[model samples]
Target: MKPRFTALLTLLVVALLGGCASQPPLRQAKDVDLARYMGTWYVIGHVPYFAEKGDVATADEYRLKPDGDIAVTYHYRKGFDAPEKTWAGKAWLPDPADTAHWKVQLVWPLRSDYVIVDLAPDYRSVLIGLPSRKLMWIMARERQLPAAEYQRLLAVAKAEGFPVDQVRKVPQRCEDLGQAGFEQP
Candidate 1:
């Protein structure tokens, strides 16, 4: 298998097996307006996945498909000067009534729950997590968040059953690239 494929598979498996300790049930965000959530969200912090290891300028973009599924794009770089690596995936609401719960698939026949644990009313901030608390992401519309705001998001994740101590802040200091030229295979 190619290194990228190995990394992606490892990510899905680790997210499922990471948090083995028994814990309280994870809660979904009260509401998620898919329309407002569609855009590039900078990954300010996260419990790093294999694909994201040593990566910087990480972000996820969501586009609504006509079928009500989401067209997902993941962008990352190995270093400040590294050309960006991009990939396409798909996400869909398993239950229409539960908009916060999503089944995301990057590789065929392998899907993981991408729950919206918390979302700001203004759509500027969001917390995405797994039911097992194994993985978590703190994202915002802006690449950099105020110190206080970042801390607040961490607190929220902790309250929501995440292992905040394991969270790593993703570096967003890379120079702006008008368009990334590489795609993951």
Candidate 2:
């Protein structure tokens, strides 16, 4: 009994210390203009969740609802030649004052964090992140970001404590453009 208690206490101490050493609270971009943010944003870079494996030419379309919830349609192709597919979800602000932090529900019951970590002044580009920076999406108005802008976003993500090395460049082809759901008039 004495040995077991000693071992358990040692583990507890290590856990507490580890928590203290963990990364600081993630910083988010302030004052997001929701209307300006609504549109089709092409995914140029991402730290994909398992479901996104082999995804190509990915994009997300957001439509602001009267009740302030965002209707999201995620479009992607499994491969370069595969047909485009879509998934739907909704995102809502947990605190009305904090527009940058959203609780996105992609499936029933479970909600995930969606933080606007960075956004271009022109609204042409943006970066959204999940908790622990384990997932992130670098999106822009076009299929790909310019080299300079991409590098700038990479630096911003790194400064924000994301694992930059884990980011995968999402493939986008000009031929994939103008798909019905991915393109908005």
Candidate 3:
């Protein structure tokens, strides 16, 4: 009877864990004009991660390289006078079928999902997320998003099963950078 009980408990645990797994076949934007999408995007909000916690004035710059790959640079400041942190990497479309889908390789042998799940018609804003819906970023062309627009984006994220409560606003004060030289592509 003890053995049978142990077997039942094992099955129950497996079932419970399975339910916590992410839903499959994650959706991505239908199509993306990589050219229009390439530019400086201020990180207005994001699902907090260890590396980005307490970060402010965060932004991402994307450049289309001659080889068709994208050069990515992430910038952020930990505090008011903290030295800025930068991470440079490359991203590419592994599947030619989907330009909206990209894999970013910031560290060797480890590629992260860079799916464009939602994008503004004029390319002013975009919602990037991973398949697991565990990580997400709400990026925009400028520093701030209107309250209504932000709410709409949050609703869209919630529909996608993201833990919206984990989303935190990122500080973006270009003046803190002491330079307004970055140009949009």
Name the lDDT value of residue 182 in candidate 3.
21
Candidate ordering by lDDT (highest first): 1, 2, 3
Residue-wise C-alpha lDDT for candidate 1, range 29-76, written one tens digit per residue: 886888988999998889876666777888999999999999998998
Against the true structure, what is each candidate's TM-score? 0.87, 0.80, 0.80
lDDT against the true structure, per candidate, is 0.80, 0.76, 0.74
Over 129-152, each residue of candidate 2 has an lDDT whose tens digit, in order, gives 765666678899998789799889
Winning candidate number (lDDT): 1
TM-score of 2: 0.80
lDDT at residue 106 of model 1 (Cα atoms)? 76
Q: Which candidate number has the best TM-score?
A: 1
lDDT of 1 at 161: 76
Candidate 3 TM-score, true structure as reference: 0.80
State the displacement of the C-alpha of residue 127, model 3, in Å, after optimal TM-score superposition: 0.6
67 in model 1: Cα distance from truth in Å?
A: 0.6
- Candidate 3 residue spans exceeding 4 A from truth: 1-21, 174-185
